[model samples]
Each structure stands twice: as structure tokens, then as C-alpha cells.
Target: MKEFALIAELTRSLPKNDTVVVGSGDDCAVLDLGLPDQFVLFKTDAVVEGMHFLTECEPEKIGRKALARCLSDIAAMGGAASSALVTIALPKKFDVEFVKRIYTGLNEIAAAHGLAIVGGETTTNPERVLISISLLGLVDKKKCILRSGAKVNDAIFVSGELGGSLAGRHLEFEPRLAEARWLAQNFQIHSMIDLSDGLASDLRHILHASKVGADILASAIPISRAAKLQARAESSSKPPLLSALTDGEDFELLFTVNTKDAVPLLDGWKKEFPKTKLSCIGKIIAGHSLKLHDKGGVRELSAKGYEHFA
Candidate 1:
């Protein structure tokens, strides 16, 4: 019942597709279109009750998040979401009104993002409620970003702020679709990922895939006000910046750009995206481990994101 074992058992191999360059086990799955002009991107994700949400949370929010989880994957790939499939397994005791509200929320968000609800299946589960979604998207082949393309000396960048999801931040998060599109159109982004897991765990996905290491400045992380407030109220100590480093479900984009192109690309992005905040917090290096630098000096980091059945 460990996390990896459960994933392997319930979600083994992906459908065989000649176009798939990389599938099923990365930040975003990639598909190659024969044409040099475009490629297809696909990703699937799930939300389970008692894990992703409180049992008492509004049903509408639950549905919105179910779809949001998948959309966030597309956003991470620098792709435009085209369609989605939704599947739900509800217990027999589920309420009719709750199901209706859930559909309402799902449809509303899907429409706003220009995604069509193409198909899905529903079944009864006696244990816990489960919502799973598969999303399809498109990106220019030349512009498609992968998790395996980072290089030494590249500047590491993260979109928007991080941390604080335990304080209701995860429920209201907006996927970085527009920002990702802007990045694709404007720069040669080397690698990218969405921060669904904590930064430490998720960053490992990018580094291990790219065969590169990174050193992040501890002070540069943007901790949300809500995270700080919660930490102080609960612990009677200074807020744990580690929460920003390891908290899951932030839904922000984490990406890298070559050092030579970083300045100009950032300048252009600033003029075009005044509201979305971007921060340069680290650099890709030639080793195999991630290091965090603070006034106290460098230290190894650990993956502290949410782990199921751990």
C-alpha cells in the first residue's frame, strides 16, 4: 500500500500510442505529431475524498478540483487544453443534489478553459469517493517543453508564489495556463513542471529526468501570508519556510531557461504579465542532488510533499 506500489497497481501502463515520446511517469506526458508544427500533450489526475479534500467540503469545490488537477498538468506542459474525460466512483449513499452540484462546477470550469467534456464513466464504490480526469492538449512541436531538457548553468524559475496550501490555498488555486502559454510563445523554456507535490519532491522529478542538479536559495522562495499566519498560530515559533519548500498542492509552474536568455525573456514577460509573479530562485548544476543555500550555508533537502499510505 505504499504510494508507488499503489500507483503501479491501479495505474500501470498507458495506452499504446505511436506518437508518445514520453508517457505515464513524468511531470507531463508528451506526444509527437508527425508534423513539425505541432504536438499533442495529455495528462490524467485524480482526487479522492479523505485525502484531497475534507468530507465536509462543498461538493462544487470537489468537482472543480477534480478537473483542475488534470488541467494543471496541461498547463505545466505549456499546452492549450482542448478536451477532458471525467470518471467518478461514488458510494450508494451519495446525495443526488451533491452530484448535480459537482457536475455544475466541473462544467463551468471546463467551459471557461475551452475544454470539451468528451466522455467518461461512472460506477459505485463501497469504500471512498473517487474522481479521475484525463485531459488532452496541444502545443507547437518546436515549443513543447519537457521535464528532461534542463542543462547546467540554466536559471531555475518558478511562476507565482509557493507554500501555504494547508490554509485553504489549494482549494482556490488557479492553474497557470495563461502564464505557461506566454512562456511558450516568448522564450525557449528548457524544462517545466507544476508544483502539485511539494517543491522538494516535485523538483526531483525535473532534476532526475533532466540528469541535472540544482541549488536553490532558501530566502528567495515566496511564502504565502496564509502559510506564515497558520504556522505562527499553531507552533508559537517562527514560520517554517520548509513548508514553502515541501508543502504540496500549490499548482504553480516551475521551469528553467538558459542563463543567456533569462534576462531578455524575463523582461518581456514582465511587460506582458504584470499581475503574474515570477521568481528566479535557483540554478541547474552538474551533480545529482539538490542543495539549499541559506545564511547558515548549504544543506541537502528532503521530499516532504504529501505521500499516500506513507
Candidate 2:
């Protein structure tokens, strides 16, 4: 069964409400709350021990990563983090101090992000560790952005470098909150998505939602330093470009701006975020497939990123 196809088939008939500003398909669901100018954003994400991390990973880092995952969802919608509820499932044989350390790390990050752990639940798992966080956020309706807003001829830009998440970058990555806020405030961003599943896979989410295609100039993508170093060390004959396309977990902002605003946004970006690298990788086209351009000429961009049930 084709994974994405199956997902589309199953969800095609799901019920929906008029109050749902943005529903299950996007990073976070935005719902009308009867507020004059705001919509509520809700998201839930989970990280498991074996899949997302090694069993020996520090409990504190795991806690931080769990919270960061949910916060990234908020960032995608250009919203403000409000509060969260965390549910933890611990192995039967775990130390109390170790658990406390996890909470301590999580609490610190929550406080820093202005999130309150209003409620949660705890349970025992057979031998694995699982942590899930459900977060609530607020976004001004007029200012909110979603994956379905892209238009043909829009310029595509991605914030920071991509790929090489396995080289400790996945655990230490910072969500692009400040960068997203700035983009929303200054630019007429049409669509946005966080790169959690690599550019090749995640870009399709935007294309499908927007009913548009993209033509990416492969030479323009900013591959990560870690990805380049890893390619050199492995000597596997694979290019760092492949990693940038499929490595996933980069958490950078992949957004589109009006073609007219692209020049100004890139120009002003240099002065405001001198440290961050922004690249114009592509343009949104009036179709529903992803195409990549290189010296070899143009071809379809494959969707090979992580998918659980593919």
C-alpha cells in the first residue's frame, strides 16, 4: 500500500466543521474560539525511546526534545505557545531520581517558552519509554499562516541549513519560533511548514494543500555542515544533497513569500538575522507535483522521508 495514498483515502471522508480554520492535514489544527480576532491552535506529538532516541539517551534531553516537538508545531502556524499537557509512560523498572530529572528539564523549557503544564497523566509501559505532549496556542486570525495558502509563482525560501540530524543535531536543534514570528510580521508569507520529515517529503504537504507544484533549483539548497562532514566520513558515494533531501528532523522554516516580496525579504534578512542562512530554493507552480532542477536537467522530486506505515 502506498503510504500517502492510503492516508488520503482513509481521511477523505472524515467529518469536518466550519469552525476549523485549519484541520488535521496541517502541522497544527486551528479552530475558532469565538474570539474577535484569534484562533486556537492545537497539536500533539510523541517521541519514543527506540524510534526517536537510544535507550541510553539522557532523560533530560528526551524531555526537552518532547516539548520542543510540540512547540515546533506552534511555530509553524505563526502562533504563540500558551500551555501544554504531558503524558509519560515509563518502563516498569525506572529510578525515581531519573524521572525527576526528566521533569526538571521539561519544566525549565516549558517555563522558558511561557507554557504551563496544566494537566497530564502517568502510566507504566512494558519496557519502552514514551512521552507525548499536547499543546495549545493562540494565533491572530489575520496573521495566521497555513500550508494551503501558497499560490502559483510564489517564491520559496527555507531558513537555515538542512539534513544530518543523526549527528546530534536532532537532539539539540532549536525550533524556529523567533524566525517564524519575524517572517509573519514582515512578509506576506503564503504557506509554511517545518521540515521534520526532510524537504522531499515535507514539501509535498504544502504542494498538496496549496494545489500547486514546485520547481526547486537544486544548486540553491543550503545543505548542512554536518551532512557534508558525514558524507565525507562514510565514503558511501552518496552526496550530501541526498541527506538534505531525506535526512529529516531539521525543524527549519520552509515558507513561501509573494514573488514581489522575495527580494526585499532576502535583502532585509541579511541585516536582521546575519547569523541565519536563508535560501530561495524554488518557486510554487500551478500544479501538484514537485520537480527538481540540476545540471542533469529537471525530474520529479521523490518522497522518501520517514513514514510510519508506508
Candidate 3:
């Protein structure tokens, strides 16, 4: 089955559980902790051989990416990471030193982030290497951001640049957990999501949840320097804007806040995250579709970034 179809089917088949504060369709599943101000955010992600990484790629980097991807989900919720557990599937003919390096990479990052690697299962696959990490985090119930809170006229913003992940940023990108937390504490962020699936596709998730549309200005879209350089080199007809629109795996944060507070947030962001880039590319609308404001015209957004099915 296609990725999204399988996701929908599973979401429907799963029995509703009352303990889930925010369930399927979000970056993380928030569980009720029965505390007035706290919620638990849970996420798990995997990196597989030949798909997520080259079979010849360093095993250590592969292990690091597996854990980082799951941690990105926690950052999307503006949560404080707590701990992690890992599952590994290795080929029967694997070398011991190679496995040790993989864990070495994973342990290094985990220690830096204070994410304790508690326990996990390992098995022999005899075909491909597969590493999965389950991450637990804590969020303030009052401050936790979800994709469903966007309101009409809310300003949309994205952190850092987008596109050209294939140029190598994807493997070494840092999760914006610190920035997300700072934003939640300082600004009234209405809704937030990590830009793992590109702006066009991921923004749709916010629209679906908030029952709102967005009007994105083509000129205002933030194009990463890497994407611009790549576009120039490719000499392809696709514009840099297209790259910024469709390139997934950026791992940046896309969020929305009230128009009134947008100015202050932007003003404070400079002093707070001096090296990070932030852009206001759009505004939420009352409808249920995305419209792009191109030069002298408007058009509906097209199939974007990477989707497993399409």
C-alpha cells in the first residue's frame, strides 16, 4: 500500500484510546499524564538500508540518523526530550567492529542530548540493516503546539532554509528543539510542525487539522543558499521556489502565530537565534485549499516534495 493510505487505514483501525492527548496524524502522540501541566510526547522512526541510507554509507551515520529523526518529532511538539530505546536488525554476516561504530555514533549523540538509551531489541535480518528509535519527551500541556491550532489570518513562518538536503544537510542537520522551546516560551505559537516532508505537503497537514487554508507568497518563500546554488548548477527549468516547495527532509520547523504577535516574534528571533533564518511566507485563510501568489497571478499548489505513493 502507499504510505499515506496505509497510514489512514491504520489510523482508522486502531481503537480510540482516552489516554492519548494528541494521537495519530500528528508528529508525536501525546499521552495524558494526569498532571495539569504536563503531557508525554512519544515518537519512533526508522532508517533502512538502500532507502534511507546507502548500503555503503557509514554505519555510524546511519544509526545517528535513525535517532535524530525521532528526536525531530519531539522538537516539533516543543518538548524536552527524556529518553530513548533502540531496535536494531543486522545481517547475520555483520562484523562486530561495524556494529560497535554504529552504537558509538548513537551513544555519542544520545549523551550530548541527555537522552538515555534504556533498552532495546536486536535481531538478525541477513539482508539489510534497520535501526529504529523510540523517543519519549515531556511537554507543557499549556504550551504544547499542535498542527490543529492555526486560525484564520495567522502568520506562517519557517525556520532555517529549505531544499537541497541531498547536497548533504539531511545527514547532519540538528533538531530545532532548543529553538522550538524558546519560541513556545516567548511567543504564542498557534501551531507548529517539523518540515520533514517539505513545505507544500507538510503545510497541508496543518490545514487538514486546523480546517484552514494558506496563501503563500512566491517571493517571500525562503530559498536556502544550497538550493539556489544547486538550482543554478542543474540548469533545469524548475525554479528555486519549486525546490524550496517540494524538497523534503529539510528538518526545519514550520509554524504559525497570530498576526499581532508576528512582529515581536520576528524581532526577538534575531537576538535569540542569530544564525537561524526565519521567514513569513504566508497567512492562513478561511478556506480549505492552498493558493500560491505568484507574479501577477494565483494558482493552486501542485504535488510536492516526496511522497512514497506519488
Q: Estimate each model's TM-score.
A: 0.91, 0.94, 0.94
Displacement of the residue 79 alpha carbon in candidate 1, Å = 0.5
All candidates: CA RMSD (Å): 3.7, 3.3, 3.0
lDDT of each: 0.83, 0.87, 0.86
Instruction: Name the candidate, 1 or 3, with the larger lDDT value.
Output: 3
Best by lDDT: 2
- Pairs clashing in candidate 2? none
Error of 1 at 54 (Å): 1.8
Q: Name the lDDT value of residue 30 in candidate 2.
A: 95
lDDT tens per residue, model 2, 214-261: 999888999999999999999774478888988999999899988999
For model 1, state the Cα shift of residue 144 in Å.
1.0
Cα displacement (angstroms), candidate 3, residue 292, comes to 1.2
Clashing pairs in 3: 246-305
lDDT of 1 by residue, 1-310 (tens): 1775686676676477688787776656788867577788878888888999876888888888898878888888888899989999999898888888888889988988999999999999998889999888888887888888899999998877777786787777888888889888888899999998878878888998899899998888877777787688876643457778777899999999999988997788789888878888899999988988887777777685222211
Q: What order do candidates take by lDDT, descending?
A: 2, 3, 1
Write one digit per residue (lDDT tens) for candidate 3, span 20-138. 88788899999997877899998988888887887676777777778888888898998988999899999989888888888988987788788899999999897998898988999
